[model samples]
Target: MRPFSLRVFVPSGDPTGVLIATRDDGIGKATIFSRSLLGEVKGRKEWNLPGIYLLVGPSKLYIGEGDPVGKRLEDHAAKKAFWERALYFTAETRLNKAHIQHLESKLVKLAQEAGVVPLDNGNTPQAPALGEEEYAFVENVLADLLLMLPLLGYPQFEASEVAAASSDEEVDAPHAAATGKRRAAYSAMPRGLLFHSTSKDARATIETVDGGVLLKAGSIVASEPAPSFDVWMPKYAQMRRQLIESGVIDAQDGRLVVKQDQFFSSASGAATVVRGVSSNADGWIGADGQNLGDLLRQWKQKNFC
Candidate 1:
């Protein structure tokens, strides 16, 4: 068996929900799940996580004004109701007025900065009636948790080794077919990567194949290819142009345009859009040392020029 390791980093002091795992020998890869930034999990810590959070920020606040924003807003309200009790039970009761009030102040600051009007003073802040301020603060806390996850681990999380599956079956399947004794090597596959354009004009699509990796438009940027996963690169002018024209992608949002692939919808069956830098360590093409724009320019010179 290949050497395997499983380690996770949850920032020392931050409360963001982040899951970082590294697998196999040192050669194995590392993956990070930004619970807050990815919006994959509601709370970064089982207890200290906030209830309602707003995605509004200078970043491409994946949640927008029209249908997208409206839908997410509705879900946030429903989540407050459905998970209210459970979330409270899991909260870090250790939080005192000082802590809670500090968070509250931060929420107010963020809201005002973002131009969000505060809810009426009469509204309750917790479950059954969580105030807008409380909700927005939770989101801020979530983002903080995500930022801290990478710092949590000493070296990073690790993953266990997984054996590669064998294709040969029954020994003589192919030979049997030739001799009329058995069937031929049959490997049904799923097609994937149908629509990989960063351009919003290009509708993200995926054809079923034996092995499928759906890369859709507006998908979140990540090192690995998976559901709600994507990489944002405004450097791709073609992609940026399409997204800007499509009215779905926003350039000033500090996020690259990436649509979702229907094949890999959220557990809620909704399309997910995350904003962040690549967390795949070495998996990212030009992450640490090189600038993406420089690389793109080189690519254009070689291929287009």
Candidate 2:
């Protein structure tokens, strides 16, 4: 990606209430404020303008728009307890109600389709009609927002790693099959390594990806976490419970089978969740049957040099 300039300001020396602005002329600005800072955020001049905003917490998300944004945020702060932080988007020139409404509807649809975060929005808002220029402007704003949100520690707007991987597979499959050379090039490329659990009873394969590790679809997880599971791997244990509750894993033939492709942020995370024990990065192996550490070193040497 090409380099772009971003200016960030902390009004009260608190990192939680940050103002982010891009140097790009048409891209606009975003204010990231913690829910605790609602009173301070409300005092900002931006709140009086028409804008779209995102309310995000650890696991839940809500998207909204307001003609005068401060009132909406004030209402949410009073009634909504799940959100810890909010991100508000506004233009250089104040947006009209119709423009903000259209942007809100599109962002809500995007969040719902991504399915990475649980949406707290009870109902989907209808998008207002827009002229060609207005629609194009909103689209550009959306693209910029997606890039900026991740930088501000919110990745819920981005597509899930599994979805991105699946898209890559679809695009590469036919070309690799037709050219044969494509397959050779891929085999030679320093891509994410794959591995299998060393546990005798666990029939699972895992692969590391750009942002996370994948517990491939159809892999097996323990029906219940190990007795020492929480003591050794508290996060994975919690994730396992969440997976079960989310219906991503189901008991089938006396074992837990993954219902779909699942992504974890690290190899050890995926391994612990699948094997129910603490795992080391060295435990995994790559396509050439080398240990993960060695494979990674080799990849870095070849690519970075």
Candidate 3:
């Protein structure tokens, strides 16, 4: 890939002004995001809203967006995966921390070299004006950068995976490769016993033992109280069904075995709640609310989006 390009908009208020980089990209893929009034400018007629596109060949691809000559090329290595795999390339700045500083620095230099002036007053600026030559230069850099992302393992799944598979006979749905599993690792569960309580402490604490969730509020209470686990609710229908299919519990058995309840709630929870399973971790709903929070945070940290 070539260097990434940077684009800035000068804010309306100032001129001796400030230049705020709105979007930066390696070709079609950009990290900095921005919107333009030109899209709504009255009677401009020929100006079109910017969009990304790819021109594909037997063994190569050409990717780009907007006028290439006008943009400033910066770092392209950081944006490879998004252009190739993501349906749209928009990520929280934190998600690209490793490369943000480097790219940001390069943009400042490029903007100044191009005689682009900052809006001033320390506020964000509007996009700088680009001559026909400059705009085309930036466009080329962006397109080249976009072309490089595919080489970095950004699009691992082939076109066949992207296309919907046709079938005469119904089969299991294809899942994302993140889990590397054929079908959902867990099945739906049936409604069963429930226990609810609230903790008064500042920090939330939870533990799972004997197939039951243990919630601890703080030192506020002398001992952790156990809630009733006998009542079944409709929400658990899917969980119950999964347990029955897994052979972990026999529905007709009048006796409520603790082992059966444990199996149904954990290993055999509903597939809807089981985000996925891996070789070591069995993904399922957490027994305690805190556990659920932890699971969600982990998903976010991994940048599942």
Tell me the tens digit of each residue's lDDT in model 3 across 1-305: 33554554444444323222333543333322112221222122112223332322233332333322112111222323222211122122221222222222223333332332331113222324444444344434433433443443223112222212112011122345422221212111122423222232111223333332333222111121111000111123333334444644332334211123232222212221111111011222345533232333344355433
lDDT of 1 by residue, 1-305 (tens): 22334455454334444443333222112223332333433333432322222332222121111121223334544543311211111123433333344333433333333333332223223222334454444434433432332344311111132112112222112353332311111112223313221222222322222322233445433221211111112122223233445644543345444543333211101112222211111111222454222332343355444
TM-score of each: 0.19, 0.52, 0.17
Error of 3 at 172 (Å): 15
The most accurate candidate by lDDT is 2
Tell me which residue pairs clash in candidate 2: none
TM-score of 2: 0.52
Model 1 score (lDDT): 0.29
**Per-residue lDDT of candidate 2, residues 66-165 (tens digit):** 8788889889998998898898888747478888887788777777766779899999898786655665566566666766778877787655433111
**Each model's C-alpha lDDT?**
0.29, 0.68, 0.27
Reference-based TM-score, model 3: 0.17
Judging by TM-score, tell me the better candidate of 2 and 3: 2
